[model samples]
Target: MPELPEVETVRRTLNQLIKGKKIDHVTVHLARIIQRPDDIKQFEIMLAGHTIVEVERRGKFLRIIMDGLILISHLRMEGRYGLFTSSDPVAKHTHVIFHFNDGTELRYKDVRQFGTMHLFNPGEEFQLPPLSKLGLEPLEESFTLEQFKAVLIGKKTKIKSVLLNQAYVVGIGNIYVDEALFKAGIHPEQSVNSLTDSQFERLHNAIVSTLSESVEAGGSSIKSYVNGQGEMGMFQHQLQVYGRQAQPCENCGSMIEKTIVGGRGTHYCPKCQLYK
Candidate 1:
């Protein structure tokens, strides 16, 4: 799954490519991918002829702002978007196509067919599921160290699980969670309540620094993830422990190990991230 950085990168790229383009028509090859309106015809009719005003992201979802409606799209694992000329042949697994009046089409392709789209009124999007329950943005001014620590108080869940929960802190996934825990010198299996105030501060900083750096580098392309322009991210080169199991730790030269924590495959340095 694409994390915050990857989703943000896609939002930035799609905003540049599709903004101001009028939708001449919409083609839904997979009917189930459209979750809004329930009726496919209504979905197509509502989107057609509407101009894309902007593209924004909340958590892992993308919102394509139009004249009066907002199209909220979640690109689950293996889903991607690309822009092509209408004359070009559509690629396989292309689930949705937004045909623009300028003879170009924005295509959504998801090999796993797990992507979803929901249409909502302008001001009602955040009041509903998915976006409504998401926690503060880690990079934003609202996510302070005190707020982060306060959320963890009295929680018995593993630190890794707590961070992965979008209700507590949005935009973190398995890869980045492992990296953040490792950077903070906290074992993934550590209980949230076991962390000291100093440890919480370090973890908070690690989360912010890791995400900010990944966004700047486009995001880690560990699998099939790519930006809206079909460009692979460069952050994978900077990974410390996420996919580097059995590799030497950069800080302590200790062998990085992998273990299952809260049902997720977690990687960490045994010596550096000592269990306390």
Candidate 2:
């Protein structure tokens, strides 16, 4: 799953490529990918001639704003978008294609077919599913330290699980969660209710700093992530613990370890983030 930085990078790239481009047509090869309106044909018809006014991102969801409707796209694991000439051969696993009037097309390819798209009226997207359930974007002014702490209070879930919950704070997945926890020196299994104000502050700062830096670096290309132009991200090169199990920690030379927390593989430095 592409986290906040990766999704934000994709949004920036898509904004540059597809904004102002009028949709010539839309092809939905995988009907199951369209969730809203529950009709693939309606999804295609609504976007056929709509012009992309702007591209925005809410958490990990890509919001492609058109004339009166908004297309909410979530590129789940192994999902990616790329812009190509209409004459270019469609790649394998291309599930959706948004053809542009300029002879170009934005292709969505997902090997796992786990990506999803929902079409909603511009003002109604937030009042319904998906977007309605998402929590605040960490970069937004509304996600203050106090708010983050308040959400953690009385929550018995592990700190990692709380951070991963989209209802609590959106756009964080396994990779970035591990990275953020490692940076904050908070063990993935630490109880959320047990964290002190100082630890909460550290975790908050780590989330913001990690995401900001990754967005600047074009997001981490850990798996199949790429931008609108089919470019790979560069932030994976700076990863501290993710996918580095048994490797020495960069900070203290302690061996990085991996364990399953909340059914997800988690990596951290035991020496740095030991159980309290």
Candidate 3:
């Protein structure tokens, strides 16, 4: 799944491509992907004739701001968006297509068919599920070290599980969680309460810096992820431990190990991130 950096990169690329373009029509080949209004026709009618005012991202969800309605889209695993001329042949997995008045179309393709779209009225999106329960953005100024520490108090869950929880910190998935934990030199299986003040501070800084650097590098392309322009991310070159199982660690020359933590595959350097 694409994490914060990948989603932010998609938002940036999508904004550049589709912003200000009027939706001439909408075709939903997969009705199950539309979760709002529970009616496919209503979803199509509400979106037609409205211009895509802007594209914003809340956590991993893409907010397609239109004239009067907001379309919230979550691109789950194997989901991608691309812009192409109307004459271009639609791909086999293309699930949704937003035909623009300018003879271009914004297409959403999902191999797993797990992507979702919800249409909501302006200002009402955050009051509902998914977005309502999300925690603070790590990149934002509001996510201070004090707030982060406060959220972790009394939590008995493993640190990896806690980090994956959207209520604790939004937009972090397995890939970045492993990367962040490895960078902080904290074992993924450690309990949240076991972390000391200094460890928490290190973890906080690692989370922020890892995400910031990944976003600047266009996110890690570990899987099939790509931005709206179909460009692969460059951050995969900077990965420390994630997906480097059995490979030599750059810092200590020890073999990077992989283990299951909280049901997710975790990678770390055994010598660096030793269990406490």
Candidate 4:
């Protein structure tokens, strides 16, 4: 699954590719991928001639802005998008295609068929499920140490679990949770409330730095993830502990360990992130 950085990178690339392109028609190869309006045909009919105003990212979802309606798309595990001329042959596993007036098509391909799209009125998008319950954006200036500390108050769950919860903060996933916790030198299984002020500050900084750096690097492409232009991210080459199990820690030279935390595969430096 693409985390915050990957999703943000998609938004940036898609905006550049299709921001002003007008949708002449839409074709849905898989009906179940469209989850909005409950009627698949109506979803296609309404999008006709709608101009692509811009693209936005909320949590792990993409909001393709239009005139009065917003198309919220969630790119699950294997979802990827690419822009191609209409004359190009459609590739296998292509699920959705947004045909633009300029003879170009934006294709959505997902091998797992787990991607979802929901259409909602502009005013109702933020008040509904998925977008409504999400917490502060870690990449934004509002997600300060004080704001993060507030989410940890009275929480006894493992720190990794808390960070993975979208209700606490949006855009965090297993990869980032493990990487950020490792950078902060905090054990993934440590209780949230047990963190001191210094630890809290370090964790906060780690999360932001890890995410922002990944975004700057165009996001990690450990899997089949790609940008709107079919470009793979380069951040995976710089990862420290996420997938470096049994590798020597870059800082302390301790062997990186892998364990299951809250049902997710977690990696960290056991000696550096020693539990209290």
Query: Per-residue CA lDDT of candidate 1, range 204-259, in tens?
Result: 99999999999999999988999999999999999999889989999999999999
| TM-score of each candidate structure, all chains considered together | 0.98, 0.97, 0.98, 0.98
**Superposition-based RMSD of candidate 3 using all C-alpha atoms, in angstroms:** 0.9
When 2 and 4 are scored with lDDT, the better candidate is 4
lDDT of each: 0.93, 0.91, 0.93, 0.92
Task: Rank the models by TM-score, top first.
Answer: 4, 1, 3, 2
Candidate 3 per-residue lDDT, tens place, 102-144, comes to 9999999999999999999999999997589998789999989
Task: Give every collision pair in model 1.
Answer: none
- For 92-204, candidate 2 gives per-residue lDDT tens digits of 99999999999999999999999999999878999988899888689888889999887678888898888889998999889889999988989999898889888889999
Candidate 2: pairs in clash: none
